[model samples]
Target: MDAAPLAARVTRIATLVAGLPALPPDDGSRYSPRRLTVSWLLEAESVHTEIAHARDLGAFLDWCNRERLDPLTARPTDLAQFKVWRGAGTGGTPAAASTVARALASISSWYTHLVANTDGGVTRNPVAAVKRPPVNRHTSTTAGLTLDEVDALLAAADAQAGARAAAAGRTPTGQARYLAALRDRALLRLLADLGLRISEALDRDLGDLSNNAGHRTLRFVGKGGVHRERPLTPHSLQALDEYLAARAAAAGTTADRLSGPIFATTGAGGDGRLAEPNIFMTLRRLARIAGIASADRLSPHSLRHAFATGAREAGIALEDVQDAMGHADPRTTRRYDRDRHNLDRDPAFVLGARRASRRSGNQR
Candidate 1:
């Protein structure tokens, strides 16, 4: 095979992977092992997952190119070296254990697909013989907001919306700003209230909101393409209603007539769906206005962390919280709870409380 630029190879691989299903059925004669392997491996994955896998694999392919090694025929020793290089940071800063683990997982999945689909063309997965970094499942490194911080963030968003609303009728610019502020307020409320993944929240359409058993609920396609519904809290519903009303007013229509993205750009020609970066920037700006100490590091996920931690601290059962967060594994939910290992909530404290109560009863 001819040596190709890394970017070109990645682009070609992505195109091939996306087009695989449309190709007519044929024997192994048509495609290269690499193309067939990537296509089959990522066929069932969502677009987001496919892109991530491609990126991770692309990094490894780039490394192989630099090392004068063929990725398809790479040995265990080659993978071991690649792992060390990746962990040590292709840049100056070392990658996190979880990141390295994910990269290795992507590579391993690729080789596994090749071995399974190619008969005896590939003997084994080289990544199988390589040791992977241990990922800590009990905790995450993403910063979490406290209940007070969550309140402050909401207040900040509300204040901005209020200010913008006052000027909305004056000019077109004012109306646009007011609309955007309303959207931001509602988006923040939903994130804090529901702990939705940013992607899940952004993917919402106005039509997704419906009455389920007389309760207002949001239907979203969550991780793994699972359809899930979460009942909206009164506060979340109110925020959403206000935003929708404002959006409809801006469009010279009623709230009932509005449809499409729940959070959309204010631009006239832009797609209605709000991008993830927009939410990220919005959160950081609100965090700064809220005087949060971690304002610089604040992200939309911080509100999700706040939801999980606040719910757990308020004595919500782990299983219930896990269900609300749409986590398949309780451990993943636990990772979002900042106080999962808090000493103050230890079983010893519960035991001590019971002992004290028993002593009082005995004296009585």
Candidate 2:
């Protein structure tokens, strides 16, 4: 629990992780040491939401290597067959269409990486042509918690806090209460209010929050390496300020330097102490406690969806929602427009049709 030795270990881990290069300068035809280092980092971070799914990603990569299905040379048929192979019962049940689609997306991104790093003449992305099962474009309502559900989740967290304090043989009436209720309430509110991807929130640095001339904005690095700024609401800002204060006190530090992680592990680093717990882990725990879904529905991405749905209901302009969601294509933004679903249920459609038929019968 000593600060000096704890800081030293943190420094050592950072040194090792920081030594990794972002990407290879040249193509993989000529493997450089720097390329190897970058490769190692990519593989290490490949431990995604599911290790089993990540293994499938590796298998797909291996398939590409064996088939020599380079984007530069492979035909559409070849790509289609590869997709079929992925879903076929080669050993077990066929892979889900959604899973196959996800793998294809990852492969498409990998191809984009290749094109960016080397030649830019990979004319076609075959994955674009592959016909898969129709995907329901509707965002799932099952995952996101309504306002009432959020209240229930918050209550559950408070109850857990009480149990913890009781077990510690102390009155549940001091820092313990603040740590449990305030810290986690702020975290959940940030997710719901901002619609921040868990990773985006986790990746937040102190400098990401800025106030200038009485306006507050939270800067975030979004997907596809895009940087975005979202105006912070008064409630969000207040919660953020309180969380920051509590965080500083917990660390036993006073300097509010706009550097270092916005969030970090409590206490000293050890075998159990996380220098930085993965944001996804925080989401999973929260979901488990809140009883959100039987399957995994608690992640940064789910929160992002919840934000989009909330905005749609609030009658925010589609363009504004698109910008908030950090969507590249307007068509992708169009998908989030829940207006169409409501329009589909209009009485005009059924009533107008019946009236027209009745008028036609009279005319006959």
Candidate 3:
């Protein structure tokens, strides 16, 4: 019997009422409960601004129902008005072309659902009548570290930080230094040796890295949900062993556990309970330390690209590279080598050379 709880109940009812679709022929039957729920989920999935856009769309449909405007009979002009209204005002800024396309797709899905279930057989979907905005193809080339640059980065990483840490155990000032070196070296070797996406690398759990005949082999999932296996190269295997040893020493925990993130902070305390490193933060740190090009977007992806390109330049086959990178589509793998391969035979280079002397040019 409290006013506050009563007010809360009324507010919830009001919100649900605001989200309902327009009424059908028979007043009570038009806005079926099932239709409304499905429409809500459909619209929610389609638009990025789900709640507001769904409310607006529901309001518009409700208006059409009040006016007895049959969606089946609605013309292109009505849809155009809706598009203009969407771009101009009501709730939020103009939707992206992709967003609009998705909204239309949601509408189509609802209509199709109705067609299959309801007695009011749908003749044609209204969304198909609307034309979508044209999208421009992005023609700019993708930039990645070249083979020489990749070598330089790995060498720089090894010489600048990796090597110094490896020598940490020789003296008393180097204990923590040794652990840090092993971790970083393991990270770099994983990136260079396996051509792993940063996300893929960081997603690894302790169980993902397994030992087979003293050789470390990694099993992980890749893009588009494909499972792949990559044998750790000798260099990477050594780094991993060192890193695991260092990790076990710091945590006083078993490295061969079936749980916990594969890579984590060495020491415990203050949220360092053996968790994964954020990919973005890790890449930013690497860029700062490596002193690579500041103009290019050099993230963990750059490391993957460098690995693929380096292998290709070293005469590794496209199919092998595709399997190694866990790319479902070989065409995606081909893009990595397109620019580098073209540079080898670029016409601009061949034709732009200065001709010293045309000594035999018809004896002048």
Candidate 4:
């Protein structure tokens, strides 16, 4: 195999892994074993996951270049040093334990692929010898909104929509603002009520909304490419209906004729799907309007956390909450439950009561 420069090889592999077009090999030969392995790994991952992996891998490759270490030939000690550097706040504030852990996992996966496919060229995975930082699975660091804050946020969205709708008759830019407000209202409702990841909500099309067994539901592709449906609450359905109505009015068409993205962009000359940054800005703006303490830090994930936490607080079954949040593991769902530490529901209390009852029966 031809020895390509490490950076060049990484670029080509990342491009291929992202399912993007890549330049032909310089010698017009087959791809190297490492590239082929990356392709295989790409098969099971979503585009978002592949992009994140590429970013993490790029950071590691840059560090290797700076240290004069060959990633393909680096030893266990080299990986250990890299882990320390990754968490050392070299660029700015130190990375979180979860962030460091994810980076190591990315590097480990890369080596695992190479070791499995490179025959004898790459002997073993050095990352395996490095200990990863312990991440707490029982608690989440993501900002969360209280149930009252969520209600206030929804009210703010509703107020914005109403104001914009009234202004639509007076100004040229008012129609666009009105349409965007309507979209934001519906988007927030879905996030708060259904516990959808932002990507899942943005990926929805008009066609994804349907009636299932007398329930109105929105179908979305969740993480790991799992197909799932969430029933729309009455509030969500109403918000969606209002948004579609406004969209149809702006487009000079009927709502039923709309066919593309459910939350299409409202910017001039842009009719594509809504992007994550747009949603992030919307959330922050609405949160500020709602007077939320964590407005500046609010993201779509905050609503997801709120949904899980609120559901658990409402006495919803844990398994049902897990399914709603699309968590593959119950423990992951538990992590989002802010009330997980509530001693009122402790099993120890029940066990102690049982013991007391047994002793009382023996006295009788």
Q: Which number leads on TM-score?
A: 1
lDDT of 3 at 172: 41
Positional deviation of residue 1's Cα in model 2 after best superposition, in angstroms: 30
Q: Report per-prediction Cα RMSD to one decimal.
A: 6.3, 8.2, 11.6, 6.1
Model 3 segments beyond 4 Å from truth?
1-142, 159-181, 212-215, 266-278, 338-364
Tell me the deviation in Å of residue 124 in model 3.
Answer: 14
For model 3 the TM-score comes to 0.54
Model 1, residue pairs in steric clash: none
lDDT of the candidates, in the order given: 0.82, 0.57, 0.60, 0.82
Write down the TM-score of every candidate.
0.83, 0.63, 0.54, 0.82
lDDT tens digits, residue span 1-364, model 2:
2475447644543344344232224454533433422343343321233233334445665676677654345666876887888877467798767767767766555445444554544445666676765555544433555555555555665565455444332433355445444445556667777777666665566677876557888887776667878878776666667666755565466537423656544434201222224445655675677776632655455556657766877778778888887887767655545444677557799999999999999999
Please provide, for model 1 over 267-334, each residue's C-alpha lDDT reduced to its tens digit, 9 standing for 90 to 100: 89322778787888888898999999998898888889999999999999999999999899998998
Q: How many backbone clashes does candidate 3 have?
A: 1
**How many angstroms is residue 358 displaced in model 2 relative to the true structure, after the best TM-score fit?**
22
* Candidate 4 minimal-lDDT segment of 10 residues: 20-29
The clash tally of candidate 2 reads 1
Candidate 2: C-alpha RMSD to true structure equals 8.2
